[model samples]
Target: MEPRWLSQDEQESWLPFAAMLIKLPAALDAQLQRDADITHFEYLVLARLSMIRDRTLRMSELASVVSASLSRLSHVVKRLEQRGWVRRAPCPENGRFTNAILTEAGWEKVVATAPGHVEEVRRLVVDALSESELRQLREISSRVLQRIDPDAGTW
Candidate 1:
């Protein structure tokens, strides 16, 4: 079968998007590293846990939420544990599965880090877009995500 290729207009659209995929993570990581002494992914793991009701989640579920592998999450969690920011234990409901729980320190870390992080996000993304462009970006990203994985739910 012949492969379908991007047309000129499609290529023009995709190039900037592709560059953003490369640049944005580095930019966010840089800010997080400089301000909080954490990587963006680490901050994400902490922030996501903070958002949950109990500040706990099963390892597998947390991995899915962060789009990470269990091994990677476990390693990060280990580092967090060393910092007294997170803890891990067998889930009470199912002993076979482990749960990651944010400690008081972890919550505090998120609280302290969030303002700077939010400011960076706002300055880089939100402030750069008009309201209409923001809506369009959201819609376009959602559509792309749906196409990539129809079963995936919003975060």
Candidate 2:
């Protein structure tokens, strides 16, 4: 079988898109490291946890929300727990399930860290686009994400 190589137009568009995929995470992580002493992924986990009611989520649901593996999130959560930001407990509704609960300190951490993180995000990505462009970017990214993980309903 033969491969379907990209056309020149496709290649041109893909080149920059691929570069963004490579660089964006690093850029965000660097900003987070300098300002918050945490990686962007950690910020995401904490921020997501803070948003939900009760500031808690099932371990599996948290993993899915962050688009990470359970093991990976567990490691991050462990670090957070060590920092007094999060605690884990058996789910009230299901004895076999566990929940990650954000502590008071965790809420404070999120509140403290959010502004700088948001500023960096705006500086790096959001402010670079016009209003219309922002909408288009969301639509386009959603399309690509649909293709990448078609069964992901939450995204």
Candidate 3:
């Protein structure tokens, strides 16, 4: 068997793609930590929970939303729990499952942090692209995500 290799065009595209993957998260995290005292991942977890009617999600579902391991999500939620932003309890419907519930303070934190985060996101990524570019970016992201996790549901 011969080793498969990236062609020149593939290599060229990957360079910038990989760089953006590295740089974008760092930039987003810096803004989040400085303004909201939360990392981007934590913000994502909170944001996802906030959009639900109950502001709560089963722990396993949350791990999927954040694309995190169960262990990692548990650790992060514990930190949020200590801050009085979220609580973990056994699901009443199914004691086998744990639920992560956003507290009043967590909702307030999301409300406070969202506007600034939105502005920064627009300034950094959305504003830099045209309408067509935005659509193209979405398509590109979806294609890559499908390749990575075919069983994944919409987030």
Worst 10 residues of 1 by lDDT: 146-155
lDDT of 1 by residue, 109-149 (tens): 99999999999999999999999999999999999899998
CA deviation > 4 Å runs, candidate 2: none
Instruction: Count backbone clashes in candidate 1.
Output: 0
TM-score of each: 0.92, 0.95, 0.93
Best by TM-score: 2
| Candidate 2 structure lDDT | 0.94
Task: State the lDDT of candidate 3 residue by residue for 1-155, as single tens digits.
Answer: 99989999999999999999999999999999999999999999999999998998999999987889999999999999999999999998889999999999999999999999999999999999999999999999999889998877464
After aligning candidate 2 to the native by TM-score, how far in Å is the CA of 57 from where it should be?
1.0
Candidate 1 regions with alpha-carbon error over 4 angstroms? 1-3
From the highest TM-score down, the ranking of the candidates is: 2, 3, 1
State the lDDT of candidate 2 residue by residue for 1-155, as single tens digits: 89999999999999999999999999999988998899899999999999999999999999998999999999999999999999999987889889999999999999999999899889989999999999999999889899998888565
Q: After superposition, how far is residue 101 of candidate 1 from its true place, in Å?
A: 1.0
